[model samples]
Target: MPTQIVNIKDQLFENIFDHAPNGVAIVGLDFRWVKVNQSLMDLLGYSEEEFYAMTFPDITHKDDVAADMELLGQLLNGAINRYQIEKRYFHKTGKVIWGLLSVSFERSPIDGAPLYFISQIVDITRQKEMIGQMNAITNIANIQNEKLKNFAHIATHDIRTHLGNLGVISGFMEEELEVLKNNENFLMLKEALSQLESTIDNLNEVRKSDFSTEERMTSLNLKDFVDSAIYNINAIARHEQCKLINEVDGTFNVMAVAVYLDSVILNLLTNAIKYSSKERQSYVHLRSLESEDYIILEVHDNGMGIDMEVHQAELFQFKKTFHNRADARGIGLFLTKNHVESMGGKITVESRVDVGTTFRVFLRKA
Candidate 1:
C-alpha cells in the first residue's frame, strides 16, 4: 500500500510539470540538461531525448555564450537570486530562436549546495523580426532623401544655365538698338531678362553646394580660410567701409571639406558687407575657439541687423530675402547653410534690430 501511494504522488507531480504554460528546464552544475519539459522540446523542434544528450552551451548561440556564462557565474557566486535575460539559441532545423530565458537555482537538502538550475523560456522570434523590418524601412528613407537632393541640383542648374544664355543675348540686343529700347515690348523683354538673370545667379549657388555629409575632411586653418573669403569680398567691404579683422589664432584648425567651407565663409562675409550699419564705422571680425566637442567660428559684424521676431523663421530658407536690396538674390545664406551642414557643422545667427548680427558656425574638431 505504501509503495502504491508513493508512485501515484510521483505521477501527479510529473503531470503538473508537463502541463506548465512555459518551457521548463532543469540543468545541472555541469551545464548539462537533467530534465526538459515537452514545451521546450516543441519550441526548439527537437525531441526530449535529443535535448537530454545535449548541453546548454551546445544549443546556445555562439554570440550569446559569453554573456550567458558571465551571468551564470554571478548566480553561482550568490550575487543574484535569479536572472532573466533575452538570448538567442539555435533551433534544430538551423534557424535562430530568440528566447526570453529566466533561470533560478535549487539547493541540496543536506549541505545547501546548489543542486540544479531551473529555467523557463518564452519565444520572442516575432518581435525580433519586427525590429529588423523597421531598420530596413529607415535605410530606404535615407536613400530616397539623398536622391531628391541630387535631383534638385540637376534641375535648377540645367534650366538656369539655359535661361542665363538667353539673357546675355537679350543684353547684347539692348546695346545694338538703344532707340528701340523705348518701345513697350522692348522694355518688357528687358525686365524679364533681368529677372531671369537673378534667378540664374541664385540657382548657381545651389549648383555649387556640397550635399554629402559623409565626406572625409582634412584639417583647415581657420585664419587662412577667413583671409581668402575677405579677398573674394574685398570690393564690397571697401565700398561699405567695413574693416575685415582676422582675429582667429593661427593654430586653430577644424575638419571640413575645403570647397564647402569656402562657400560658407564667403557668404557670411558678403552678407556682413551688404548690411553694414551706416551710423557707425562697420566692422566684420573672424574669430575661432575650441569648445568641448566642436571648433566654433564666429563672423561678428556691426550691420543693419535683422528683426529676429519677424524674419527669424525664414533666415536660411532658399530664396528667403528680407532686405529689399535689388541684388539680394536670397540664395547666399541658404547655400551657406547647406554647405555648413554637409561638413558636419551647423550655423546659427543672433541678431537684434539696429544692434548687429553674429553668425556662429560649429565645425567638427580635427
Candidate 2:
C-alpha cells in the first residue's frame, strides 16, 4: 500500500477504537484479548495490562461461558457473520456486569485470514435493576389485592346481617311503642324511643366508617378516646347489663385519624358486650402499652371468646358471625380492623371459648 493510504487507514482505526461510546474489544481468532480501549477498561474494571493478559473466556462469567463458547463455535463455522446477545462479564473485582454484546468477524488485510473478533458491549445494569424493583412492587401489590378482596367480601356479609337485625328490632320497637302509646308508662316508653334513636345514629356512623377523606394523621390519646367512646355507648352497656373497666392510664398517643380511631374503639367495645356469655354479666377492659414505634391498645373482655382454630381465618371477614344468634351481625371486628389498617395500623385477636377475647390494636407511634 502507498504511505498516504496506510496513514489514513491507521487514523480511521484509531478513531474507531478510541472514540466509541460502547466498550470495544479486539480479540485474536484464538479468543485471546488483542486490544482494549478506555470504555472496555471502565466497563470491566480492568487495567489495560490486566485485560491484555486475560483471554475473552477468562473474563466471561462461568455460568455464561458454556453458552458463549457454543455461540463462538457457530460463528467460526460461518453460520453467522454477526450476532448480538445479552451476556455477563466478570469484572476484575469479581462482580458480574450485564452487557448487550455484539460480535463480528474481520478479515486481515495482509493475510485474508480471520485475524480479528470485534465485540461491542453496551452496559445494561441499571435497566436490570429497575426491572427487579418493578417485579418486587408487583408482587407486593398482588398480595395486597387478595387481602383487600377477602376483606370486602366479609364486610358486605356482616353489614347485611346487622341491617337485618336492626330492621327486626326497629319493627318490634314500633309495635311495642304503638301498644304503649296510650298506656300509663308513656314517659318510660318515650325514653326508650330516644335511646333507640341514639343507638341507630351510632350504628349509622359505624356503617359510614369509610375514613378516606382524612389526609392527615397524628398521635391520639387512647385513654381519652376510649373514655369518650364509652360515654357514647354507656346507655347500651347499661341496658345490656355490662360494665366497662378502664385500665388505660395516661395518654398513649398513636398516629391515626380521629374518626377512624373512635369507630375502631367503639366497635370492639360493643362487640365484646354483644357477645358476652348469656349466663354471666359482661365486662370489658381497655388497656394500653407504649413501645418504640407503636402504641398497643388491647381491648379485653370476659365475654364469649372465639375458637381460634376454627374462626381465626374468618375473624376479620365482614358479616361472618360465629354464633348462630339473632344479634350476631359480625361487622364489629371487620370495621375495627379496616379502620385500624387504613390509618397505617394493625389489629390482631387472641381468644379462647368462654374464657374471653383480647383484641390488640397496634398503631404507629406518635
Candidate 3:
C-alpha cells in the first residue's frame, strides 16, 4: 500500500507538470534538455525528441545567448537562487519568439551537488508585437504633428507679409480714388480683404494653442473672469441688441491657463451674441457648476440655435459654419475647444434650433 501511494503521488505530479499552460522543462547542468513537456515543444515548434537532442543555447537567439548564460552562471555559483528574464528564442521554423523565462537551480538530495534546472517559459510574442505596433503609430503621429507646426509657422510669416502689402495698396487706392471707394466692386474687394485678414489672425490663434508646449495654469475666480469678458464684449453685445448676463458664483475658483481661459470665454460670449435670434429677446448668460474634479462654466444664449443632428460632427472643426452669417469665420468654437483641451479640460454643447444654445466648459478645480 505504501509503494502504491508513492506511485500515485508521482503520477499526479507528472500530470500537473505535463499539462501546465506555459512551457516547462528540466535541463541538465551541461545545458542540454533532460526533459521537456508538450507545451515547451509546441512553443519552440520542435518535437520532444528534437528538443532532447538539443541544448538551450542552440535555440536561443544569438544576441541573447551571452546574457542568458551569465544569469545561469550566477545561479551555478549560488549568487542567485532563481532568475527571470525576457529573452528571445529561435523557433524551429526560423521565426523569433519572445518569452518570459523563469529558472531555478535544483540540487542533489544527499550530496548538495548541482543536479539540474527547472525552467518556465511564458510566450510573450503577441504582447511584444502589439507594443511594437503602438510605438510605430506614436512615432508617425509625432512626425506629422511636427510637420504641421512647421507649415503653420511658414504660412503665418509669409502670408502676413502679403496681406500687409495688400492692406497698404488698398489704403492708397481709397485715398487716391474717392469715387472708386463708393463703387460696389471696390467695397466688395475691401470687405473680402478685411475678412482674409481676420481669417489669418484666427489661424495664428489656433496655431498658438495647438502647438503651445508649456501651459502655465493659475487659479482664477470664475465670476471675475466672466465679468471681465462681459466688459470687453459689452459693446458688441449691445450693438447686436443682445444682453450679456453674469450669473457665475463669486467664490468659484478654477485652474486654467489665463490666456486660454480668456479666449474660451470671449469666443463663447461673442458667438452667442453673434448668432442671436431676431425673433426673440436675445441674451447671453454665464453661470457655473461644480464637480468633484472640475468646475463647469455654462454659457447659455437665446440665439439662433444649431441643428445638432446635422452639424454636431463638424461643430468644432476649423472653418466649419452652421449658420449663414457674413462674419461667421467658424474659428471661434474651434479655437475655444483647442484652448480648453490644451489645458486638460473639455467643452460640450447643447442646443435646440431657434430656441437656445448652451456651451459647457469644464476646467480643473483649483
Tell me, by lDDT, which candidate is best: 3
lDDT of 3 at 71: 95
Winner on lDDT between 2 and 3 is 3
Cα deviation at 157, candidate 3, in Å, is 7.5
Off by over 4 Å in 1: 1-17, 108-111, 177-366
**Model 3, runs deviating above 4 Å:** 1-5, 141-215, 221-253, 278-281, 287-296, 307-348, 362-366
Q: Which of 1 and 3 is the better model by lDDT?
A: 3
Task: Put down candidate 3 lDDT per residue, 1-366, tens digits, no spaces.
Answer: 599999999899799789999999999999999999999889999998899889999999889999999999999999999999999999999999999999997898889999999999999999999999999999999999899988998998899899899989989999998898789667766665765576567567667774452445778888877876776666677789998878898989988766677779989988898889999889988889999989999999989999999999999999999987787898889999998988889999999999999999998889
Overall lDDT per candidate, in order of appearance = 0.83, 0.80, 0.88
* Model 1 pairs whose backbones collide: none
Residue 134 of model 3, lDDT score? 100
2 versus 3: better TM-score goes to? 3
Candidate 3 residue pairs in clash (backbone atoms < 3 Å): none
Task: Output the lDDT of residue 285, model 1.
Answer: 89
Worst 10 residues of 1 by lDDT: 198-207
> What is the descending lDDT order?
3, 1, 2
TM-score of each: 0.46, 0.46, 0.70
